[model samples]
Target: MTYSGSNYRGAASVPPAGGSGGARVAAAAGGGPTRRGLIGSAIGLVASVAAAGGGFSVWSTANDANSDLDRAFDLGDLEDRPEDTPALNVLILGSDHREGNAEEDARSDTAMIMHVNEGGTEAYAISIPRDLYVPIPEDPDAAYYPDYTGTNAKFNAAYAWGGVNTTVKTVEALTGVRIDHIVEIDFNGLIEVVDALGGIDIDVEVPEGQDTVTSIHEPYREFSEGVNHLNGEEALDYVRQRKQYADGDFARMRHQQDLIKAIMDSALTAGVLTDRGKLTAFIESTSDAIKVDTDFNVVGTAIELMGLRSDDIVFMTTPNLGTGDQGGESVVIYADDPENPEASNPEAVSLWEALREDTMAEWVEDNPEAAGQDEGE
Candidate 1:
């Protein structure tokens, strides 16, 4: 369970190229597909060739997208993460924003903590509710805008108030873990990525209802449920719709995780990693919407992460059951207590601890049914 940073092959001893102090870890560990001299030599060669001719270009263009996205928001000063850390925690923020999306800019609809073990073989993602009440950090140096008020506010508002830095800091304070990277993707990018992959297949447990706008200004549409294959827009609607579900944002988070699993499964089956054109397009189209820490480069990081199989990844929500009043606002509390565990039980914490220690296979062994499904591409 003790992860040695030295075991990772691609992490730069010094700083990575083209970034502040962020280190790029090569993807050779059990995390993704980082086998160097070819386990499947023929396929590797073909993939390499395809990648060089098209995949690499697509990746470069995708980097351009990141550059374009940077113009719209303030990417905080890069944090210098020490190399010896046991796990790399990344805050994955999914925004509802689209082109000229003024209304959606007010909040972050989805948030998840992606914890990748230092060795890179395993990953555990824990989704956090957007409506959770937390204190917004104050920015003393801002000349144009005064510091934020209120002791506690909805978590998503952190992004609207001070952008990524504030959100990251807030989450770090909440989780007691330092985030090594932050990746934010918007609705347009999500749709494009799904489309680039030829649409993702997802299983809808509850039947989907149509969204009929009461007024012309509101968006309206309908969706049929029951394990239907969803295209880009439908998939977006599937994850974004919450009013129909009883749990609202909580249900939406579960649906989002389900969609991600489906996407991963489909991507694996479609051989997206080997398909140079599709892979490049996927990266390029999504690049603009994705904002990562200076240390995280998609291509370089993915290349290092190639060792990870779909089955190796595990996803869960933060253990929470009841609601409470914080600062006169309703909020979900994560893990009320260790002894009398409610939603955030010791089991959930232990699950995360197991993930940080790279002992997730043990956890999966106990839950064979959940582990049995085919991890789509």
Candidate 2:
């Protein structure tokens, strides 16, 4: 269906496949990074500090700051849910919008599902590889591509074909996890957001055999080994590199995660929340760069996650069998074939079950290999 400008009055509850789904909360909204172009920055960080007693007034102020983004996009259908929900699942899409490219032509560069568990104490950012093969639901109201027949394609193609709503449906169908909110971010704006923070420090580690990673884009900035202070432009260049590293896109994903953590840390340590001037500049820069679904209450969501520290959030990739070739296309292979259970990854299925049940803390402990290692881990 086409976007009808209808706001999600409350959390939309979709039962998890094969599980007695519980009430899912929809209180927090913010950015969580995932892939090569995945950049949510600290938009949610604004509310995160609120969890630390920033107060309802501060949250209201921040919400007012982002008033323009209140209805940034029309997310087709979401029901008003009870406040007693257990967890909040947010679909954070990092879109790559190149010069002269229309929004319809943009593909999701990064697609991550961030699950904020009960009590809002822990959050998990799980990256869904853009190239993962999945079934794309038919979008009859597709704006740009009217000929879209919606068949199996790369995961990101959902956005390319019908936009964020399609991607939302595709992800829900694939993972069996209901999304409570949506945050779409243009990584291109990272230049200004990072610059606003006075630059972020990142420990750039090229593969063991390589000395440095060079930018594929213009200016070709060179990022050397060890911790480097990067301006916005240089930082963009750094996260965009994948071919230079032996792990390819995985390396890029790692860098993006590190950059995200760095941005959050920078904002908190720089006292952006305390400093009126810096806070205004940061919020302005961020609000201009991101579009949130109408239902996402910036301040309310942040207040819900007030107890969440930066460290409490962990990043990981969806369980997969690495990369493989499908129909002459390089794709990430995962156990998503429900028609043939023999073809699905048991671990992947388990992951989805854990997410729906809000048992990620236990899931991570049971499957440490699937958990992503942090910057120095």
Task: State each model's CA lDDT, in order.
Answer: 0.51, 0.67
On a 0 to 1 TM-score scale, where does candidate 2 land against the true structure?
A: 0.84
Model 1 misses residue 210 by how many Å?
13
**Candidate 1 stretches greater than 4 Å from native:** 1-84, 101-104, 141-146, 207-219, 271-276, 326-328, 335-377
Candidate 2 local lDDT, 69-152, one digit each (tens): 645666656332222235777788877775588888777768778777755556788878778777776767665663673678
Worst 10 residues of 2 by lDDT: 1-10
lDDT of 1 by residue, 1-377 (tens): 32333322122222133322212322222111100000111111112222333433543554444344343333345343223356656567776555775742445657777666665555666676777665555654322222662345677777766666777766655544666556666666667666877887777755335333111113555554557787777777667666666576666676777776665565555477667667656545555435455544334344344334444456556655556776577777544542234355555555545554556567666644333333462
Q: Give the poorly placed runs of model 2, Cα more than 4 Å off.
A: 1-31, 34-37, 49-60, 78-85, 98-100, 336-343, 373-377
RMSD of each: 8.6, 7.4
Question: How high is the lDDT of residue 202 in model 1?
Answer: 75
